[model samples]
Structures are given as structure tokens and as C-alpha cells.
Target: MRRLLQKVLDKSQKAPTQDAPGSTASEITPQVMDGVGTGSEAVDNTQAVGTNPIKISSVQRLGFQNASNSCSHRDLGFTGKIAGKWYAVFGDTLWCAPGVKDPAQDLPGFHGMVRDSVSLLTNDPLTVVDLNLNNDSPVKHQLQFVPFNPAWGETNMYGFGGTSLCETDARSGTGAVYYLVNANDAGLIGAGVAKVVVKSGTPTVTQRYDGTKGHWWDAKTTARYGDVAAYRDERSEYIYLLGHPPSTITGWLAASYVYMARVRATDAFDLTKYQYWWGRQQGWKTKVLNVFTPETAVMWGTGQGQISWNAYYGCYVFVHLAIGGGTVHLRTAPAPAGPWSGDVQVYTAAPIDGGLVYAGVAHPYLDASGKTLVVSFTNNNHIEVIKVAFTK
Candidate 1:
């Protein structure tokens, strides 16, 4: 516990004082609101999205939902290391749904409302936002659960799915944080961004939603490049972003194409500084208009997932979901830009209560050996964890 506390305090000191080269703090005004109240678990909305729930013996279940205080959330389980501690962030959370016992039905007032939350992870169980360390908030010492967007669940104008995070190169003391938030509805309002600044062991988070959203690479429309996963390249002074280009609709399953982009370590928030990977022939393109299209996707057939460097495989591993099917697929590349290997079926997700299982991602920080992985995906209204090991 002392080690965890030290890590949090250490991250506070490393917060950057300014945005990247082209971006400034005064550009977007922040809106600060109180934390969300706790409630009962929620059930899955009626959508025949993915395959039915099937338990596989090889895929070891970690039971993250059973261990946490807030067990009922549709979390992507996108994790990152903060102060050497692994933390998972959830997207659409249910505070108080009508029926807790019934898995098939969602009440009218409910329908799986979204309230984003974060979790602290251990081996067997995961801790939710209710950690009562020491704080003056109304939650009383608990880490506050703030919504990524206050208007997240509002009809078609401003409904959001969730966000993907990356440790930026811009650092002062040690740690730097940034999020590529995809905040849109069925009507296609598209995405935005949020910056999390830690100070003196406490965190200050801010979100911006408007016309000029999505910063550098992505646009504020469904037809633009939206960030799905991000990681800072240890070999280079840049952070590589894995984008899901919704415009490249090869099939009805989802965007079958993915793209790559990078920004300098110090200029993470400067969207204008981002450059897209245009393949080995063309290299990186500085102009957004000349960036990647469907023809230049880093990988195809999977639109959503996460990327991390795997020492075991000696490659950059991309673990993504079969959006239309209930399977988790993986690809490996020498660099973030590819010669990416073809899809390998790592795990098969079994959706509960006729729910669609998607958001297959790997927690790279949890795996010490690249051969064994800690993976997470959403089932119905909750998230589940599993272990996948590859033989040498």
C-alpha cells in the first residue's frame, strides 16, 4: 500500500505546465462538476450485437466485475500504468438500474446510462472508485468518479461511448497523461479530448466538447479518424495513436480499417503537430489532408482495440475485437506502422443475456511476460477479465 501511495504522489510532481507546441491551455475552457453517486447494477440493453456467452477452459476468467465495488459497468477495460499501478477506465456506467437480478431486461429509465469511472487493480480483485484514502469531497476520502462528459447520455446530440488514454512524452517530474475521447451519438456528433493533470497526489481532469474537437488527426464527424488506442514508443520520442477510421466502411460489421499517427513527446496536445503514417513508401505525412485513408490502414478487418510493445513476441502487439463476431483477434508488427501480421484468434467472448460482446483490449502493464496477457472485454452491461497465454 505504501508503494501505491508513493506512486500516486510521484505522478503529481510530473504534470506538464503547458500544452504542446501549437496548443495552449487558454484555448479550451474547462467545466468542473461534482462526483457521481453510487447505485445498483445495470443489465444489458436489448441488442443482438455479438455472439452468445460461451465459457472456454483455456481462457482463465479473472472476475474483475465480482471483485469491484461498482460491478455493473460497460467498461472497455483500457488500462495504463500510473505511478507503476495499473488502473482501468470504464465508459458507460450504470449507477441505479431498475432490475439487478434480471440480466435480459433493461428498464425504461435505465437503458444502460453512461457514467464513466476508473478502477485500481490487483491480482484477484479490482478496486473501484470507492477507495477511501484521504479527501475532503462529499464522497469522503473516496476517489471521486467524474463523468468524462456531463452531456454523455443526452439523446443523439451528445452521446459518448468512452475514451482511450496514453502517457504523453511531455513530462516535468515523471508522469504525463492525455485522453482521446470519442464523444458522439447515432446522429454522429463525433469526438473530443480531455487532459488529466495530477498535482500533489490529487488529480484535476478537464473535458472539452465543441465543433473544433478531436484535435489534430480526428474530426468531429463519423467519417473521420477517431482514436481507439495509444502508447508512447519507448524507442522514440513520440506517442503512437491507433485510430479507427469510421469512413473506411469495407463491410457492415464496422470500420474494417485502422490507421496510425504520432506526435512529439513535448507537443502531445498540439493537434497541428500530429503526423500520420502513410506507409513505408510515403513515410509519415505532416498534413492532415494527406494523412491515411482506407488504402493506407495499418491493419484491416478490425476497427477497435489497444496496442502495446511485447518483449516476448519481439513486436508491437495489437489486440482487437471482431466487431461483428464474438471473438478477440490479435496482430503483431515490427513497428507501429506495420508489416503487421494477420489476425490470430486469442480469445472468444461469450455475451451474456443476448448482449453483444466487444471492446477486446489487453492490459500491457499487467503482463510481465509478453507470452501471457491480461485481457478484458465488455459483456452485456459489465466487463470481464481473462488470461491468454501463447506457447513458445
Candidate 2:
């Protein structure tokens, strides 16, 4: 227990000790707000969503629901440490209706294991966030649950392992590996990052940095897309990560674009070595604010997103919750930093027939045949997995 507590504290600081000498910590001022509160054991939102609960299990590779509704899955959550190893994405937001329940009431909200299928993990609140009294007030001071809602839920936190582990490259599906996951400060709006060894077959927590928000690649910034998807671009030998910077629009935190950032894959854990895709015609530029003004060539299918290299297509394929949220779209790029193609249709769900649907996950590992690609998403009642075949 002491080991776990210590690990959480270590990862909580966003300021990594490995940062390049003299690097300044991004002042986490306005972008992130703060909140902390109580939680009840998971509630049954299934009744509110009007769907009867079903059993949860690994779904088949293509377009079918995983029978895990009884577990109260957070549909749009993500996974961690990809170099093809089996790891869990530890933080997840609760599945909530548009206006039905206050998500903040989801104290031990958002926690799970994101693999080929979604698995309900633990909901132990670990990271802690002490926020400025008026999160929006220019005069700042830390307060308890100051800003009520926690952002970055749908896009949960996790990243992939690099070559350092188990001979894994950017695209390997399984390996003897290390998985570093950022579990959010449970019950808090603005929380620090707790770097837990989520899954490499066994889970452990090595460190934490609790002063900033819950993502290791990010500090407390108001608008950001986190739960970073990282991979080592064997071509460039530099590790590339597709990140989303989220903003609150019309009172909901939704995202529309995907950002690019890179560092030597060996330097994956060092925040200082990383560079951002500024989207200038000139491409990547190093900046300290860690901010980007123009987005990459592609826009997000849904605020929640995913990008993976599909060998069958011979390009990086991005799968997302299509604009309306009932379908998933696929776009391809020759390079990780892309001149991306517009999305080609991939999978469509029952929303066309009238029911709520969102959260799409791509499982390239399932495409053993190389001619087929796999994708998954969930409705309030069940998690669906789909397989896509390429013709010509």
C-alpha cells in the first residue's frame, strides 16, 4: 500500500525530472480548473439511458456488441502503452446522458482497461487536484471541487510503450512490455497525473505528479485533448503522438482537431525533448507554451478519437466517431505527420435507426490477415466491434 501511495505522488508532478536542463514548467494557470468531491459506489445509469443491461465479454473482431453492459462501461475511453502489449487504460468517465445526471457526481468516474475490447477496471480515486478558488477568476486560489465538471473524460488517459520494451516498435500488438498510465485524481475537476504501471500483464504504480491536470504529456491547460496515443514511427525513428486539445463549447468539452507531437522514442517519457506540430506550412516548430494554433490536415470524427497504422492500407489510418456520432470514419496518411486523406466510411451503428451511440476504438492487432481492419464503439447498452475489409 505504501508503495502504491508513493508511486502516485511521484507521477503527480507534471514537471518531469528528466526535462532538459533549465526547462521551465508550463505555468498551468487558466486552461485548467479544479474540483474534488465524494462518490457513491457506481450507480446504474443504464435505467436512465433506457437500455437493459447485458453481460460484458470480448466482442468478435468486427461490427458486433461486446456483451458488457452490466459493468457500466465508459464508452469512449482509450488504452495505454501500445508497442503491441496488452495494457489497460485506467481512467474513464462514466457513461452519462446529455442532461440527466451531473457527471461530477461520478466521483470515482472514468476508469477502465482498453484492449481489443473494453473491460471495467477499478474506480479507485488516486490523483489529487487542489484548484484555484474561482477557476475562472483572475485572482486564483485552490478550492474544493471549484469547477464542477471534469473535462477529458471521453478521451481517457494512456500512451504506448516504445522500443525499450520487449523489442516492440510503434505497431506491434503484443510484447513483454511496460505500460505507464496517467490515472486521474479521482473525484476532482482539475487533478494531477498519477503514473501507474497499468498493464504489461501485471499492474504497478511507479510515480505521480499531482499538481497539474491528469495527463503526463500535459499540464493544467484549459483546452487540451489527452489520453495520448503514442507510437514510434520506424521511418522517422522519432516517436509520434496524436493528441487532441479539448475546449468547452456550448458548455460541453468537445474536440474537433488532432494535433501532432514527437520526440526520440527513447526519450518518450521526457516532456522536454518533445516537439509540437505547429501546423505552419513550414511544419513542426519548437515552442515553450506547448500550444499549437493550426490543426493537422484532418479534423476529428468526434471529440473522442483514435489513429493507428494499418499495414493493409500501407498508411496511418485514423478511425473516429463520425461527426453525427452514429458512424466511424477512416482516413489515411502516408506519414505519421500527415498529408491526410479525407475519411472513407468504415462502420455505422444503430443511431441511424434512433438510439444514442459514440466511442470508437481501432484494433489493428485484430487484423491478423492484414486485409481486414478492426474498429469498436459502444452505445449505452452494449459495446460493438466491427471488421473492415479493403477492396481493390
The numbered model that scores best in TM-score is: 1
Q: Candidate 1's residue-wise lDDT over 1-392, tens digit each?
A: 21221111111111112222432222322221111112332111111122312222365777645323432445566665544455555555554343342222334464334445555656653334432132332212223233343434443223344444444522432333333444453334434444544444333345343324433223322223434666666667777766555342333323444566677756766556767654443456653423223334555556567777888767777777755747887777777766566567766767787887777767766666776777777777566677876665
By summed lDDT, the worst window of 10 consecutive residues in model 2 runs over 43-52
Candidate 2 residue-wise lDDT, 98-154, digit = tens: 222332332353333332122222221111111112222222221211111144342
Kindly report which residue stretches of model 1 are placed more than 4 angstroms away from their true locations once superposed.
1-58, 64-67, 97-115, 125-157, 169-186, 199-203, 207-226, 246-254, 289-294
TM agreement with the true structure for every prediction: 0.68, 0.54
Reference-based lDDT, each prediction: 0.50, 0.38
Model 1: colliding residue pairs:
14-173, 53-350, 53-351, 54-350
What's the CA error at residue 257 for candidate 1, in Å? 1.5
Predicted structure 1, TM vs. truth: 0.68
